[model samples]
Target: MHVVEAPITITGQESRPQIRVAPPGPADRRIIDEDALYMATTTKASPVAARMARGTVVLSEDGNVFLDFTSGVGVTNTGHSHPAVVKAIQEQAAKFLHFAGTDFYYDVQSSLAKELAHAVPGTFAKKTFYTNSGTESNEAAIKIVKWSTRRPLLLAFTHAFHGRTQGTLALSSSKAVHKERFFPSMPGAFAVPYPNPYRNPFNIDGYDEPEALSDAVLSLVEDLLDAAAPASEVGAFFVEPIQGEGGYVIPPKGFFAKLKKILDGHGILMVADEVQTGFGRTGKMFAMEHFGVQPQLTTMAKAMGSGVPIGACVFDAKLDFAVSGAHSNTYGGNPIACAAGLATLRVMREEKLVERSQKMGDVLHKELEALQTEFPRIGDVRGLGLMQATEFVKDAKKTPDKDTRDRVIHEAFLRGLLLLPCGKSSIRYIPPLVVTADQIRGAMDVLRASLKAAAT
Candidate 1:
C-alpha cells in the first residue's frame, strides 16, 4: 500500500516536526491573545495556532511545522485538504453553497445520503438524516429511536462521550464539567458500565480473560433490563463501538456479540455512535464492523466530510419519521459539505485508505507496545487501527495520572507533534488514514521524548 509522502507537495506540509522559534512565538501569541478575548471558553487542547495543514502535517502560525496525530480531533481522515475533497468543495461552492435541502431538492445532498446509507453498517434497508456535527447526528438518532419505539428510556454507557447537545448530553457521562451547570438534560437516559477491558469497575484482567470481562458487564446489562430501566421501556442503546473521548477504549472481544444478543431479545435498537471512529479511523469503515454486530442505527461525522463539518444518522428505513417536518435541519446536506463528503468517500476508496489504516495500525500498535514496555508510567496502550491511545497511570493499580498526561501533551506540543487528550489521563494518537508508517514512527519518537520530558 502506498502511503501519502506528504499531505501536499506544493503546500509545504512538513513531513516531520520542526520547531523553529519554539511555540507561542510572536504570530502564535497574537492569535492566542485574540482568541482568548473573542472566542467562548471551550475545550482548548494546545496553544499552537494552526495556520494550515495537509495530510498529517500541520503548519502552525508560529511557523513551526508539526506532525499532526490528532487529525483535528478525528475529523480529517482523508488527510488535511485532500486534493479531491478540495476540488469537490470548490466546484460545489462555485455552483451554490446552501439551498436548504429540507425545503428544496438537490442532487448533491441526495447523492451523499445514498452513499452514507450504503457505507454505514447493517444489511437491512437504511436511510440517512444529515446534520451539522456529531452531536446533531446523535440527536437525530435519539429522536428516531424514541419516536419509532415510543419508549421513554434510553441506554448509554458510563464514561461515553456522546455529545454536548441537551438530547445527546443525556447519554454523555465522560465528564461532569460537560453537564455541571446544565441541569435536566433530555430526561430518561440510564447509564450502564461499558466493557472497557483496561479499567472497568470490576477490576478484571480483561487482557488475560476477555470473555470474563464481557460476562461481568453483560450481567449488569441484564440486571438493568430486569430492574429499573426495563428492556420494554428502553428504546435504544447509544454505544460507541470504541469509546473515543472517554479514552480510546475497545470493549473486550465477544462483549458486543453478547450484548447484541440481549438487545435483540428485548427488541431494543442499537445505535452505534461512529462520530469519531468512522471513516477508517479504526481500520474499518465503521468500528462496529470489527465486533460483527450490525446496529440498527449509526451516527457519523468528523471524518465523513474530511473536515467540511458534516454529520449523519443512518437508520433503518422502517424507522424513518412518519411526518415530514418531524426532524429537519436548515443547513444540513449543504452542497459544499455533501460534495466534500462524496469526495471523501471517493478518496478513501480510491486511495485504499481503509487497508492502509489496517496495515499502519499494526505498525502503530507495535511501536506503542514497544514504547509501553519502556515506560512504567504507561499503564495501558489500547485502540484499533490508527485510532489508538496510551493511558498514563501512577502504578500497577492504574490510578489516572492527569497531571502527567497534561505535561506529556504540553511537551509534545513544544516538540512540534500535535496531540489530543481523551478520557482522564489518556492521550489519543489518531493520525489521518493517509499517515504513513514513517510518520507514525516520527510521531512516536516525539512522544517518547515528551514522555521523558514530562517524567521530570
Candidate 2:
C-alpha cells in the first residue's frame, strides 16, 4: 500500500491555488448574472468566473483560487498559459497572425504538419490536414476516408463522442441530450459495442474477461455489418482508445488489435480520435501506442496546441481527397496557432511530460484504489495516466448514483477544487501534465473531504 503523506499546501506561489473569498463572491455573481442573461443556455459546470489562470490553478473573479483538475476539459495538457507557449505565440504574432494556408503557403504551417506527421503513430508516409477544433478534425477525417476509399458508410461505437459538428455529431452516441432536436445527422453512420469490461453490454460467459469482452464486441460488429451496414460501403471505423465523455472507460487489452483485424479484412480505414487522449495526456504521446494498433488516420485536438485552437487530421500518404477543394478550412494552420503547437510539442519533449504522466499515474492509481477501498460509493476507478475517473454507485447492484456524484462535484467546488463530471455517474480527473506529486495528493485530499461532506 502506498502510504498517504502529509497534505501539501500549494500556496504562496503565483501559480499555486489559494482561495481568499468563498466561491460565487460579489464579483463572480455579477459575471454569472451577466453571462446568464447574455450567454446561451448550453450549460455551465459551476458558477466560477475565472479572471486568470496559471499552471494547474485558476483565479476566479470571486477572489477564490481553485486547483483546476478538469484542465479546461482536457485542453491545457501543458498547463494554463505555459511560458514557452506564450512566448512562441507572442513571437509568431509579431511576425504574422493569419495567412490562409489553403490558398497560400506558410513555413510554420507545413513545419507543424511535418512535426505532427512524424510524431503520430505509424511508420508509413503520412499527410496532414489542419482544422480549428476536434469536431473539425473529425469532419476532415470523415471526408478524407470517404473520398479516398469512395465508400459512404462510417462506423462508431456506443457511448462514443467524436464531436458536435454535423458530420461528427452523427458519429457521436454518448448522450441523446447532445443530439436532441438536432435530428437528421449525417447519413451512413453506424454504431457498435465498444468492449468495455466494466460495463459489458453483451451477456456472455466470463464477460468481465478482456478476451471474452473483445470477442463479443467483434462478433457483434461482424453480425451488424453483415445484417445492417454493408461491409463494402463502410469507409472507416472511428474509435477513441479511451472513451472520454463516456466515463473515461478504458477498453480491454487486445481489443483494438482485434477490431483492426476486422476493419482491415473489410478494406476499411481506422480513424483514431485522439481528441482527449493525445498529446501526452495518456502517458504515451498517443493512446494508440498503448494498444500497439496503428490507425490509418487519426483526428487530434483539445491539447494539440495546449489550449490554442488548433486541430489536425493525419493519415497515410496514400489516402487523398478525390479532387482539389474537396475539403478545406479557413483559419486552419494560422501562424500563431502553429507556433503555439510547435512550442507545446517542444515543451512536451523537453520536460518529458509523457514519462512524467506515466510515473505519476502509478501514484494516482494507487491513491484512487485506496479511496475505493474506503468509500463504498466509489464503484470503479479506471483510465490511463492523467486522464482518470471514479464512478459512483448506489447499492450492491451497482446502479448509477448521479445524486451523490453531483453532490460531490458541488462540495468539491465549495472547497475550492474544480472538477467535471463525465458520463452519467463519474467524476473525471484530468489535471495538466505539469502537475506534481504534492498537487495530486492535494486533489485526492480535496476529493476525500468532498465525498465526506456529500455523504453527510
Candidate 3:
C-alpha cells in the first residue's frame, strides 16, 4: 500500500515536541493546578500534557514530543491532523457546519450513511443511525434491539467494555472501578464468559487449542440464556469482536461463528461493538469480518470520524423500527462530523491503510514477541492487526502485575513514547494506521528499554 505523504506546516511551532523542561515548569504546573481545582477527577494523568499533535506524535505543553501509541484511545487511526482530515474539516467549516440531520436533510450525512452501509460486511440491505460517541451508538443499538425483538433482556460477555452510558454500561463488565458507584444499572443484562485462552475460564490452556475454549464459552452462553433470560425475553447479544478496553483480547478463530450459531438457535440478534476495533484497526474494516460472521447490528465510533465526535449503528433493514420516535439523538448526524467521517473512509481506502495496518502489525507483533522472550515480565502478547497488547505478569503463571506495567508506561513516556495500559496489567499499542515502519521501530525500541528499566 502506497500512501501519498502530505506536507505539514505549523505556524509558530517550536522545534522538537519531546524535550520536557524541568519538573513543575510554570506553564505545566499552572494548568495542572487549574485542572485539579475545576475539572473532574476521573482520568489518571500520565504527566505529559498534549498541546498539539500530528501524525503519530503528540506535543506536550512542557515542550515534550511523545510518540503516541494510544492514537487518542484509537480515535486517530489515520493519525493526528492528517492533511486530508484537516482539509475536510476546514472545507466543511467554511460551508454549512452543523445542520441538525433530523430537522433538515443534508448531503454529507446521507452520503456518509450510504458509504458506511456499503462498507460494513454482509450483503443484506443495511441502514444507519448516527450518534456522537461509542456509548451513544451502543445506546441506539440497545433501543433498536428492543424495538426489533420486543425483548428486554440483553446478553453481554464478562470482561467486555461496551461504553459508559447507562445502556452500554449495563452491558459492560470490564471493571468495578468504572461501575462501582454508578450502578443500579439498566436491568435484565446478563454476562457470559468470553473466550480468553490465557486465563481460560474452562481451565483449558494453549492458544493453539482455542477451538475447544471457544466451545466452552459458547456453552456458557447457552446456559445463560436458559437460566437468565428465556428465549422469548432476550433482545440481543452484544460483543466486541476483539475486546478493547477489557484488554485487546482476541478470541479463538471460530468463536464468533459458533457464537452466531447459538444466537441464531435462540432467535436472538448479535450486535458487534466495533467501536475501537473498527475502521482498519483490526486489519479489516470490521473485526467480525476476520471470523467470517456478519452481525445483525454493528456499532462503530473511534476512528469513524478521525478524532471528531461521530458514531453510528448500522443494522439489517429488518431491524428498522416501524414506529417513529423509538430512538433519536439531537446530534446524531452532524454535518461537520459526517464530512469528517466521509473524509476518513475515503482516506483509508485511497491509502490502503487497512493493509498497511496489517503489515505493520506483523512487524509490531514480532518485536513484542521478541521482548516477551527477553523480558520475563511480559507474560502474553496478543492482538489483531494494529490493535495489539502486551500483558505483564509476575511469572508465567499469569498473575496480573499492574505495578510493573504502570512503571513501564511511565518509563516509556519519559523516554519519548506514549503508551496506554488496559485490562489489569496489559499495555496496548494502538498506533495510527498511518504509522510508518520506522515510527513503529522507534516506539518498540522505547518499549524495550522501558521494559528493561522496569524489570530492573
Candidate 4:
C-alpha cells in the first residue's frame, strides 16, 4: 500500500469552519430532533449536529463552521480524516475486512503490535493485547496484572477515568453520575487521593510544590494501604499520567517517578492510562515518557488509530495470560483497525507531530496564561503539549465557577467554536495535533470574546 505524502487539502474557505447559517439550522434542528427521539440519551455531546468533519474544523449541518477543540475527545490526534490514515483505510478495506487477530494470524496485527511495542516505554521485551476502546484496554490491563501477579486488589486515583465498563467504572471516580445506577462494580478496587497542588486535599505542610505534594500523597497511600488495603494483595496502581476528565489536571513534575518508587517498593505494578495522552497528545510519544517512568502495563486508545476504533494494552512480555481463552475479543486487532493504527503511527513519526505538539503546547500555555492574568476567574491553566485546560473560579478565592464555565462553553459554541468542560468548572482545550499556530490564536480569540459575552 502506498502512503500519501501530503494532507488532502480542501480548497477555498471550505478548508476551515465557515458559518453560512447558525448551527442547528433548520436541517440540523430536524436531525437533532429525530436523534433525540431515536438515539440513546448518552449519544450526543453537543447541540450542534455535525454532518462532516475535516482537520481542525467540523461542518455542522446548519452550515456553521466549528473549531473543534475537543477533537472527538482527543481521538483525532492527526486531525480528522488525515490523508495518510484515509489512504491506509481505503487500501486495507479493498483487500479484506476481518480475519480475527485473536484467533487467526494476520500480518497487519503483528506489524502494528511490533511498532507499538517498540514505541511504548519499556526496556524489556514487550507484548500487546488489542481491543476496541479505552475501557477495553483498561480491562485488559486489569486482567494481565491480576493474572501475572496473582493479586486480588487494584488501586486507582480519585478523579481517575479508566472507562465506563464495570471493571474500569469501578476504577473511576470522576463523577457519581457515571455510576449512579450501576453499583456493585467490580470488587477489590480502591480509590486514593490524586495530588492536585491547585486543589490539595491533604493540605500537608509545604504542599505548594509538586514534589512535596506527591510525597504527601504517596505517604497518604502508604498509610491507607497499611491501615485499610493490604499492599501484598494490590496488583497495580492505575493512573493517568495527566488526569483527563477530572479536569485536565497535571500533577507536579516528579509525581510519577515518586509514585513509581513507592509502588516498586511494594512489588506492585504501575499502570499508565494513556488513552487520552497517547499519540503525541502530551508532546511525548506517551505521557509516561514525560514522567521519566516506564510502567509495567500501559493502556492506550483514543488517537492510536487516528479516527478508527482501536485500543491496546502494552506490557512486559512476562505478563502474558497463561490460558489462551482467558481473555479475547473477536474484533480486537482486526486487519482494518491494525492497518489504520500502522498508518497513524507512521504519520505521527513522519510529520514529527510530537515535537509540533510541544511547540504548540507552549503556544497554548502562553496564550491561556495571558488569559488567566486578564480573567481573574481563570484560577489555573495547566497541561503539557496540546492537552491543556483553564479552570474557572468564582473569584480570587478559587471557588469553582461551574456556571461561568457552562456559559463560556455555550457562548463559544454559539460563535462556532467547540470546547469541552471537565472537573466541574474547567474547560479542556485539546485541539488536534495537526492544528496550526493561527488556528490556536483564532480559537483563543473566540474564547476571549465568549468570556466577555458570558460575563455580560
TM-score of every prediction relative to native:
0.96, 0.96, 0.94, 0.96
lDDT of 1 by residue, 185-208 (tens): 998999988877777677645434
Writing each residue's lDDT as its tens digit, candidate 3 over 72-184 gives: 89999998988898899899999987777966898999999899889998789999999999998999999999998989999998999998887789999888988989988
TM-score of 2: 0.96
Question: Please, what are the lDDT tens digits per residue for candidate 2 over residues 41-65?
Answer: 9768988998888788888876688
Per-candidate clashes come to 1, 0, 4, 0
- Pairs in steric clash, model 3: 17-64, 17-65, 18-64, 18-65
TM-score, candidate 4, is 0.96
In candidate 4, which residue pairs get closer than 3 Å at backbone N, Cα or C atoms, i.e. clash?
none
Q: Taking the tens digit of each residue's C-alpha lDDT, what string does model 4 give over 177-288?
A: 9999999999999998989879987765678777778888888889977867898889999999999999988888888888889899999999999999999999999998
Candidate 3: count the clashes: 4
Residue 184, candidate 4: C-alpha displacement in angstroms: 0.8
Count of clashes in candidate 1 = 1
Model 1 alpha-carbon drift over 4 Å, by segment: 1-13, 204-208
Q: Once model 2 is optimally superposed onto the true structure by TM-score, how far is the C-alpha of residue 190 displaced, in angstroms? A: 0.8
Q: What is residue 329's positional error in candidate 2, in angstroms?
A: 1.1
